[model samples]
Structure formats: C-alpha cells, structure tokens
Target: MGLTVMMFTALGLCWGSNFIYMKLAADFTSPAQMTLLRVCCGFVPLVLVAWWRGALKRAQLRLLPHFLVMALLATAFYYFAIAKGTERLPSAVAGVLGGTIALFTTLASLVFLRSQRPSTAMLWGVLLGFAGVVVLIAPWQDGAAPLDKQGVFWMLGAAALFGGSYVYVCRFLAPHGLPALALVTWQMGLALVLLLLVTDTSGMGELLVHPRALAGVTFGLGFLGTGMAFLLYYALLERLGAVASAAATYLTPAVALVIGWANGEVVGPRELAAAGVILLGIALMQQGRDRSKVR
Candidate 1:
C-alpha cells in the first residue's frame, strides 16, 4: 500500500482506540475536567512543533478570533459534549452514532455552504448509513434505548458542530493558504487556554492524585489520538490529497468497536451487521464524490 493509505489506516486505528480511552478516563473525571486535561496534553506537543517550525511566527494575530471560534466549536465543545454524553451511552453506540458526521457534513455542505450538490449515489449512501445506525441501535428491542432520545443526542449535536467545522475549514480556511497542521495546532492551543480559564481545576488536581488515571488520559489523548493520528492525517493529505485522507473517518468506528470489544463491551451480531452496512454506505458515498478535494 501507498504511504497515504498507511497514514490513513494508522489514523483510523489510533482514533478508534481513542473512544475506549476516553471512556475509561471519563469514569474518573468530569467531562469539563477531562476535556481540559486532554486539550492541554494535545496542545503542548503541537505548540512545540509549531514553535520549532516557526509556524507560530507567521500566524496572523488578526485571525485570532477565527481560530478561537474554530477551537471552541471543534475541539472544546465537540469533545466536552461527547464526553458528557458518553457518560450515559455505551462506547459502541457512541462510535456508531459518531460515524454520521461524514454524512452530516455532506448534507450540511450542500445546504448551508452551497458547495457540492448531493449526487444520487451520495443521497443513497447517506440514507444507507443512517439506516445502518437505526439497525445497530435496534430501537424496538426490549432493552435497547432510543438512539435519539438519550444523552447520545449531545454527541450528535457535537457531531453537527464537528461537521460544520469541517465545512468551514474546507470552504474558507483552505483557500487562505492555511496549513492543516498549523491550523490544528493553533486550534488546540487556543482551546487549551480557553478551557483552562473556565474549567474548575479541583477535579484535575484530584485526577493527578491517581497516577494511572493521569497516565492513561495523557498517553491516550495526547500521544496516540490527537498527536500521532493528526500528524499521520496531515501527512496523508500531503501525499494522497484530501479525498483519500478523509476516508480515514470510515475506519475510526471500526477501530473503536474492536477496542471496545476487547475491553469486554458486548458486540452483538446485529451491531456487526450494522457496521458492515455503514461501511458499505461510506464506500458508496466516496465513490460518488470528486476525488480531487480533501473533504
């Protein structure tokens, strides 16, 4: 396989495993506190990289507001909401639901951004993906909860913001000559500062009292998920263009499911079947898109 494919595959595996790590950490910390720590950990390395590459010196201070909004919406709000919602939802369910961000982004772009119109294949792909979600959740099952009614809605809401950020990045930032690594670095750095200001540090302090918990959150969120995965993603973008790079999102949930299963999370036959359908939908959607853009 090409370097791009390898990078994307690595990105998927790292990110998918992140859900389980986040779930584990969430058990020990409140969402805000967890978000704060994770952002801080992620930001530190990025800042070092930016400083080393002199990306920070070239950054326009006038664009601080734009970067701040993107940070708050994409990193801070997106993560806090997911963490909070996952308090009541299972990792498997959250992973499956989270996969809808791609579909949402496609629809959001067509409606709000006046970007690409949904082709027939894309429409069917979205529908199939959503149907797979419904099947995976099994709303009618005696013990199954309503997918849209629980705290999972917060995750969906987060995904919407995430999708919106993706559109914003593609539509506006990409045209302005912003490098993906620089953009992500600044976003996370700003988000870390903002989150630190408002979040109560009592929980964070308490978390440090437990070395294992701190290490788990730090390594998982910092090195593996945000740091390594994003570096690989940007590398893939440079090597393979955006379309192929963005396709990594399709693999994230699968990675999360495998990790969740290994951690003793139940993996039913229906869930596996739904995952297959979802993957099929993603394949169809990618098949219909212009392969030139990164998405």
Candidate 2:
C-alpha cells in the first residue's frame, strides 16, 4: 500500500509537470511539429522498454486497426490539442483543465457505454465538475488578463477526446489482452507517422540551433513526460486500480500550481478555488464506486 501510494504520487507529479514541458516546447515549434517530435523522440524509449518486457513479441497483429484509432484519439489529437492549447494558456490552467478529463469520461460512459449507468454520485459529480469548469473559465471576470477563450476551448476539446478515447480503450482494447506498453508503442508509432505527414518541418533547422528548445523537445517532453510518464501511469493503474489511481488527477493541480508559481506564472485565488471545486467533483465521482466499470 505504501509503495502504491508513492507510485500514485509519482504519477501525479510526472503528469502534472508535463504541462510545463509542453509550455517550454510549444513556443519553439508548431503544434503539429511539437507533438510529432514528442512522439518521435519518446518512441525510442517506449519501443526499447516494450521489447525488454517481451510485450512486442506477445502483441497481436489483428488489433492493429484498433490501435490506430486509439492513436488518433488518444495520442495524436490529445497531444496536438494540448500543444496548441498550452501555447495560449498558462501551464497551471492547462493542467487543471486536463484533470477534467475524468468528468468528461464519466459523462461519455453514460452515453455510449451500454452496460454502464450513471450513479447518483456520478451525475452530481458531473454537474459540479461542469460548474467548476465554468468558474475556472470565469468569462465574466473583469481583470487585467481574462482567460483565453481559444485556449480554454482547445483544452476542453482535448479533455473530451481524451475521455472518449479511454471509453474506446475500456470497451475495445482492454478485452484484447494486449500489453499496455505494446499498445502505446504501436499507438505512438502510428501517430508519429501521421504527424510527420501533416507537420511542417521547416522550423527544424532553427530549432536545432537552439539547444534549450532541442533539449526541451528531446528530454523534457519526450523522455520524461511522454515516455516515462506513460509507464508510471500504467503502473499506477495496475497497482492502485483505476478508481484509486485517479487520485493522481486530484493531486496534479497542486503540483502544477506550485510549479507554475515557481516559474513566475500567476496563480490567482480564483484558479485555486476552481481547482478545489474540481477536486471535490472528482472525489464525488469516486465515492463508494465499485470496480465493475472502467475509469
């Protein structure tokens, strides 16, 4: 249990800090290029790790189509949206908004997932979480800097795609008994290919000349955030189980807020209050939940 707790905390820290990495890299590259580079650089480690674990050898080629779709929804669209959104939003705000994926996931389940029904708590959680999102956006706030509507919309779209992808994973992929590493390996591989086609590489020469941007893309976003973070999250999902593993989402906002503050980003009271409300909603979503459903 202690190890589980530690892993869970580590997962939150890793994923939470990913927004900072994205923030660092976004300014240097186009969204498509940034996401492409992230997946491409991260791909090496994931492939090696999957091979080391014999996941590649054990994978079923029959599920390639599903993996392709998962790549589109989860990795391709997910990271692209985040990269574009991070360019326009504060890192902490993006991170807080990212956690709202859970709320979207629960709502999505109630619709497309036939076997799933909304619990009273989940319904309330959804409403409360939406309220928190509205407060976080605070469109009516008269201040020096209002929230970026474009950024908010992009992140919300990312969260929604993320939630829907998870539902597809729960319903389709998990039943196939594919190793998580193997799945991610293929997903990233496919995403890398697609991104390469759509992405402009004209900035590559300039980015190579800038060491900070290069390192941010190769090491910060690639290895630690994308490659290792996926491994850590999957480990937590296995050890803590899905519902409890979600505690990471609750813990991430604090990490993001602190990191963003240290990096000279503004952390206002309104943002903090919104995070608290979102946390409350997440807690309610998990309240007395059974293990029968995928989170």
Candidate 3:
C-alpha cells in the first residue's frame, strides 16, 4: 500500500493503543508523572526533527506567550487530563469519550470563531455528538454499572481542550506562519518544563520493576503515542487534507475497544453502539466544516 496509508494506519494504532498504555502504566505512576515522562520522551524526537529541518527560528521567541498557552492546552493539560481519566475509567470507555473533541470543537468554533460559521449539518452534528455522550454515560440510570463520573469529567475536559486547541491555534498561532514542526517543538518543550515544575519525579522508577508497565510507558505511551504519532500526523497532513487525515477522534476508540475487549475488559453492546453514534456525528461535522473561510 501507499506510504500515507501505512502511516495513517500506524498513527491510528498508536493513538488508539495509548489509552491502554496509560491504563497499564497507571499502576506505577501518578498522572503527573506519566504526563511528564510522555512529554519528555516525545519532545526529543520532535526537537531533533525541528533542528534537522532548521524549522526552529530565533524570532519565534516573540510568540512565546502564545506558545506557552498552546503548551498548556495542547500538550500538558490534554495529556495529563487523559492520563487521569484513563487511570480511573476502563481504557475503552476513555477512548469512546474522546470522540467528543470534535463536538466541543464545533461548538467552540460557533461561539468564539465568528469568522467560521457552522453549516446546518454541523449544528446537527453538535446535537448528535452530545446525545452520544449521554448514551455513553447514561446518567439517568440508578447505578447500573455506570461509568465513573470523575473519569468522565477528566476525559471530557481533555476532549474539550484537544478540540478547542484547534481554534486557539487558528486564532493565535496560525497567523504567525511558523513552521508547524517548530511550533509543535516549542509547545511541547514548554509543556515539558511546565510538567517538570509541578510533577514529582519520585517513584517514577517503579515502572522499571514491572516489565509490562515499563513497556507501556516506554513504547506505547511515549515513543509511539506521543513522539512518533506527532510526526506521522504531520506526514499525513502532507499527503491528505486535515479533514481527511485527522481520524483519531473516532478511529482510536474502535481500536481501544477491540484491545480492551482482548484484555478481558467488559465492553458490552451498549458501549459499541454509543461509539457508533459518536462516530457518525463526528463524520458529519467533518463533512460540514466550513472551509470556505480562512482563519
């Protein structure tokens, strides 16, 4: 098959597997520690690529204010929050909830992004996306093995941050015309520093004692999920448009569900159905995205 196809498939696998990786490593590290390690490891490959390409500009320092915020929204907060959620919820469930990023982005765009108005289908997509979340959660049930509330909070918050970061970048950073690789490198670097400042490093080596845990962090969470996934995404964007290339919002959850099932997690039909609904909504939003206007 084509290189883009291979990269797209690999990237999806990496992102989908990330939830289970976090779940695996959750036994050994705090969410903070996990985020710290993921960012630290991921940053290495990114900076190297940026250096090789000479994408890192000295003048980009003028945009440090925006980069710092992007660091929080896109890197630090998003990763930490997902780790926190995955620590509590079943990996598949966390993955399903992740589909809401598109929903949040669509809504956030309508509100904050006047330049890009939503089409009729996009509004319907917002409604259906939320309805799918409700099905996923089923809050009305009286303790019928309902999903963890706190975990849902973290996952949804992460989804919102991930989704809204698009708008944030479009408004604040995209206008700068900095190299995408360079911007990502700086954003991740700042996030690494921010995470390092607040995250305690004690007991982090505990993963070394557990082979599975160490593999989860070193392979699945950091190198593949964080670092290599970013590079693959950039490659996909080169091959396909953003709307066509970005599939993790819905794709990873399916992989996560399959992997979760293989791991003996109880993924019933209800979760599968909810995931279907969310995916449908996301597809519509993507199809309906108003691309005529440039931010």
Candidate 4:
C-alpha cells in the first residue's frame, strides 16, 4: 500500500509537469509535430523496458486493434489537443481542466459500462465538478483572466477522450491479463505510426536549431512525462484499482498551480476557488465507490 501510494504521488507530479512541457514544446512546433516527436521519443525507452521484462513477445495480436484505439484516443489525439490548447491557455488552466478526467471517467463508466453505475453521491460529484469547470472558464470574469473559448473546447474534448479511453481500458483490456509495460509500449508504437501518417517531418531541421526547445521535447515530453509517468501509472493501476489510481488527478493540479505561479502565469482567486471545488467533487466521487474491492 505504501509503495502504491508513493507511485501514485510520483505519477501525479510527473503528469502535472507535463502541461508545462507541452506549453514549452508548443512554442517551437505544431501540435501534430509535437505529438509525433513525443511518441517517437517515448517509444524508444518504453519499448526497451518492455523488451527487458520479456513482455513484448507475450502480446496477443488479436488485441492489437484495441491497443491502436487506445493509442489514438489516449495518447495521439489527447496530447495533440493539449499542445494546441496550451498554446492559447495557461499551463495551470490546462492542468485543472485535465484533472477533470476523473469526473468524465466516472460519468462515462456509468453510461457505457454495464457494471458501473452512478450512486447519488456520484451524481452530485458530477454536477459539482462540471460547475467547477464552468467557473474556471468563466468568460464573464475579468478581461485579465486570459480565457480562451477555443482552447477550453479543445481541452474539454481531450479530457472526454481520455476519460472514455480510461473506462475502455478498465472494461476491455484489464480482463485480458496482459502485462502493463508491454501494453504501454505497444500503445506508444501504434501512436507513433498513427501520428506519422498525418504529420510530416518538415520541422525536424528547425527543431534541431533550438537547443532549449529540443531539450524540452527530449526530456520533458519524452523521458519524464510520457515514458516514466506512464510506467508509474501502469504500476499504480495494477496495484490499486482504476478509481483509486485516478486519485493522481487530484495531486496534479496542485503541482501545476505551483509551477505555473512560479513561472509567472496568472492565477486569480476564481481559479483557486474553482480548483478547490473540483477537488471536493473528486473526493465525493471517490466516496461513492466501493473501495473494499479496490483496496
């Protein structure tokens, strides 16, 4: 349990930092290009780890389609939307919006999954969480708040995609008994291929010219954010159940808020209040769960 908690905490910090990295990398390249580079870079290390664990050969080819869908919805389109959104939205705002994955995941499970239904507490949580998201993006606030309608749409879309993918994995993939490392590796590989199919390498030379941007892409997006974070996340999912593992979403906003503030991003009272409400909603959502099985 202690190790699971530690892994969960570390995963939160890692994912929280990912928003800032996306912001940095977006400054240098297109969203599609950034997505392609991230998957390609993350793939190498993750694939190596999968190989070392002797998990790669154990993959069932019948499940390749599922892995491809996971890559598209969870990784490729998800990060592409984030990269584009963060170009207009602040990293902190992006993080808060991203954290709503728990809300969406819960709601999605209730609707699409036969085994998971929402309790009264879960319904209240859903309402509060949505309210918080609205408050966070209140265009009526102040002109100084830096709210972008298009960016909000993009982030919310990404969150929904991620949430749906979460339930999909829990329902379909989890029962298959595949090793998480190999599953993640295969997903990255498929995402790389999917991204390459749409995006070009025209910016490759330009990316090489900017050392700072290159570093952000290499270490921030590739090594820490994608590779290490996913590895930790899969470990937590296996140890703790999906709902419990999703608690990492709560921790990420705090880290992102601090990092964004430290980096000179504007965070007003409304943002803080909205974040608090979101956390409250998440807590309520967790309470509605059957935690005995999770533990």
Candidate 5:
C-alpha cells in the first residue's frame, strides 16, 4: 500500500525476472560475458546515485581491502557463479536454489557470529531447507531426467556467497555506519574493474543484437537488477531494518517461478512443494533469530 511496500514488492519482481533475462541472453553470450555486460550496465546508475547523495567520499578509499572483499563476495563471484549455475539449470529451478541464500545466511550467523545462539527452530529450519533442496533435485529418480548436478552445485555455491556476503556486511561494514550506497558503489566499482580485466568480452557485444535480450540486459538485469536493486535494498535497510528487508528473499523465488512458468519453463507440483518447504524453512530460521540482534 505504502511507497516502501510497493518498492519492496517491485524489488522482488526485478530480481526474480533476472533468471528469465539470463535465459533469453544465454544463446548469445558466455556466462562471464553476460555477467560482464550486467556489471558494466548496472554500474552507471549506482555511481550517479552515490554522487547525487554525496555518499561518495575520498576517505572511504581507506577501506579498499574491504571493498575488494565485498566485490568478490557480493558482486563478482556472486553474479558470475549464479550465471554459470543458471547456464545449466532451468530458470525456475535455478531461482529455487537461489532461495538457499537464507539458509546459508542463518548457518553463517550461527557459526561466525557468536552473538546469536543456535535455537531449536533454526536447526529444524536447516533440516527442512536441505530436505527441500533434495526433493527439488530428486536424486532418487534414475529413469527420468533429473536436475543438472553441476548447475545445482553452482547455484548452491552462489547461494553460499550470497549468504556469506550478509555476514561480511554485518561483521565488517555495518560497524562503520557508512552510507550503504557508498559501500556498494565502491564494491561494485572494483568488481567492474576486476571483471573487465579478466572477462573476454569479444562476443559479449553480440547479445545486444537481440532486442528482447538487449532490453532485458540493459534495463531488466543491469539497471533494475543490479543498480536499482541495491538502491532499493539500502532504502529498505533504512526503513524496514535488516531482518524485515531480508524477507524479500521469500517473494523473489516465487516470482521467479511464476515468471518461469509463464515463459514456458517446466513448473510442476514437485517444484511448488519444494518452494513451499524452503519458504517454511526460511520462516522458521528467521523466527529463531528474531529480536536476537547483537547489542
């Protein structure tokens, strides 16, 4: 109803549709090439915003090491790994695995941050989330085509990075009370530089020839998904606080599944059930850690 709520909802859609965009672009570009395009396109708006808000500061250069760490953890590896993962998996299935971010985040918190003690509900959530993943992958079925193993692992790895980035932010970045935009700007900037140097971008330009994939890459995936998404995330962090904002994870996979279905990717009862279980697991994990923030 309210503006923030609307923004929150829109954020989920933007992220969810990213998979569809990737699927559209897959035929034209390699995973690194696609990620390079995304990172480059996404960087423009973020830098502009940081400048407009006066969030960019020269002194922040002192935090270069942290920025690079975040660059790898959040932007570089996160995007590329997910792209690699999605390359082999269906958009809907990849999106579901991406939901594992919450599970890993909770696990990271339990292991890395002693401030929050492990609770019974949290442990159960871990189990439920794992079981959901197993069901989603369906290793038992040998006759029919099972989910791609490599893709699933890549997605899981990306999810782990996603989950770990939150802890990295909580432990290292949050203490400074730096403007979130500034930190992200620096992180993404470095990631862009790193990706440009390493990625072979020769054929990358070919993807832009396709109108749909082009629009999706420049706008859907880049401007909205990367740049604006972080802008929205920081805004939500300010308004909703961390725990509540993180709940957006719940909406993202569902939106991705719906979009995937509409886009003609296979969506059956098994995926739906797995999604429900994963969501429930996330709910339980969050419940266990509620109001238990570090003092």
Candidate 6:
C-alpha cells in the first residue's frame, strides 16, 4: 500500500508535467502531428516491453476489436482533443479540466454502467469537486481568455470517452485475463495506425525542424509521461485499490500549477483557492468510499 501511494504520487507528478511538455511541443507541432508522434513514441517502448515479457503471444485474437476501441477512445480521441484544447488554454487550466476525469468516471459508472449509486456524501463530494474546477478556470472572470468554449467542450468529450473506456476495460477485458501491459500495448499500437490514417505529414515535417520541440515530444511521449507513468499507474491500482489510486487526479493539478508557474504562466490567488477546494472535495469522495466499504 505504501509503495502504491508513492507510485500514485509519481504518476500525478509525471502526468501533470506532461501539460508543460505538451505546451512546449505545441509551439512547433500541430495537434495532429503532436498526437501522431506522441502515440507512436509511446507505442514503441510498450511493444518492446510486452515482447520482452513474452506477453505478445498471449494476446487474444478475438480481442482485437476491444483493443481498437480502447485505442480510439483513450489515445486517439483523448490525446487529440487534449492537444488541441491545450493549444487554446493555459496548461494550468487544462490540468484543472483534466482533473475532472475522476468525477466524470464516477458519474458515468453510476449512470451508464449501473455499477454503484453514489451516496449522499459522495454526491456532495462530486458537487464540491465540480465547484472547485469552476473556480479554478473562472470562465466568467474579466480579462481571462475568452474560455474557448469549443476547446472546453472537446476536453470534456475526451474525458467522457476515456471514462467509458475504463469501464469497458474493467467490465469485459480484465475478466478475460488480459494483462495490463499487453492491453496498453495493443491499444497504443492500434491507435498509431488510426492516427496515421488522419495525420498530416506536412505538419510533422514542420515539427521535426525544432530540436527542443522534438526532445519534448520524445520525453513526454516515450518515457516520463506515458510509458513509465502508465506502468506505475496500473501497478499502483493493483496494490492500493482504485480509491487510493484515484488520488492521483487530485494531485496532478497541483503539480501542473507549479510547472505552469515555472514556465511563467500567470496564476491567480483564486486559482490556488480553487485547487484547495478541489483537493478537499477529492478527499471527501475518496473517504466516502472508505465509509461504504466499512458499511
């Protein structure tokens, strides 16, 4: 459990830092190019790891459709929408919005999956979390970016799809004895093909000209953000249980805020306050789960 908490913490830090890296790369890369490169880079190491572990041979042929759907929802749609959204919003704002994934996942689990209905405490926790996000983004604030309604919508769409994909994975795939690494590898590999189908090679050509941008893409996509972080995340979830694992979502925004500040992004007192509230809300929700277990 202790190790799991540490892994969750590290995953939050790495994923939060991904926003800064994406911001840097976005300067030199279009959304399509960025998604294509990131997915490609992420796929390579996963493939190597799966092969090294002898898991490649165990992959189910019939599960190809499931893997393809996972890739489309989790990688292709999620990353493409997020990259495009981050181009318009600040990294800090993007992080805050991304943090809402847990909230959406909980709601979706209840409504669509019919897994568990949230208790009164859980309901309050959800509301508080949503309020915190609104405060952090402050879409109504004067002098803030015009909110980029389209970008916000896209990010939310990505979050919903990602949440749904997770549900599918837990319900169907896990029971079939799919190892996490193998599943992730197959998903990313399929996503690579799907992305290539739509990506503009001309935009990729423009991105390769900038060494720093290329390095950022390589680091964020290949190692720090996706490859290592996801491996740790699955391990942590296995050890710590989902509630503790989910705490990573709350911590990610704080990490991103620090990274954004270091990158000279403007952050206000209100944002800080909002982050605090969001953390409190996440705590409430997590603790509510504990209470449920006890009951």
- Which pairs clash inside model 2? none
lDDT of 5 by residue, 58-105 (tens): 888888899999997789989999888888999999999988989998
lDDT of 5 at 1: 39
Question: How much RMSD separates candidate 6 from the native structure?
Answer: 2.1
Instruction: List the pairs of residues colliding in candidate 5.
Output: none
Give the per-residue lDDT of model 2 (tens digit) for 1-295. Answer: 7887777777778778878877877767788888888898888888888888888853477888898898888999899998888889999999899889988888888888887877788778888988989988988877568888999999999999988887898888888777787889999989998888888898677787778878877787888778887887778777766666777778777888888888899998988999889989878877724533545
Question: lDDT per prediction?
Answer: 0.77, 0.83, 0.86, 0.84, 0.87, 0.79
State the lDDT of candidate 1 residue by residue for 135-206, as single tens digits. 886768886545546666787788788988978787767777876778888889889888988998775676
**Pick by lDDT: 2 or 6, better one:** 2
Q: What value does the lDDT take at residue 29 in candidate 3?
A: 92
State in Å the error of residue 282, model 1.
1.7
C-alpha RMSD of each candidate structure in angstroms = 2.6, 2.3, 1.8, 2.4, 1.6, 2.1
TM-score of every candidate relative to the true structure: 0.91, 0.92, 0.96, 0.91, 0.96, 0.91
lDDT of 6: 0.79
Overall local distance difference test of candidate 5: 0.87
Which pairs clash inside model 4? none
Clashes of 4: 0
What does the lDDT read for residue 99 in candidate 4?
A: 87
lDDT of 4 by residue, 1-295 (tens): 7877778878888888888888876767888888888888888879887888788874477899899999888989988898888778899998898889888988898899887767878888888998999889886666564588899999899989988997888878999888878778888899999898889778676878888888887778788788888778777877876767778888987888888888799888988988989989989878876552354
Clashes of each: 1, 0, 0, 0, 0, 0
Between candidates 1 and 5, name the one with more favorable TM-score: 5
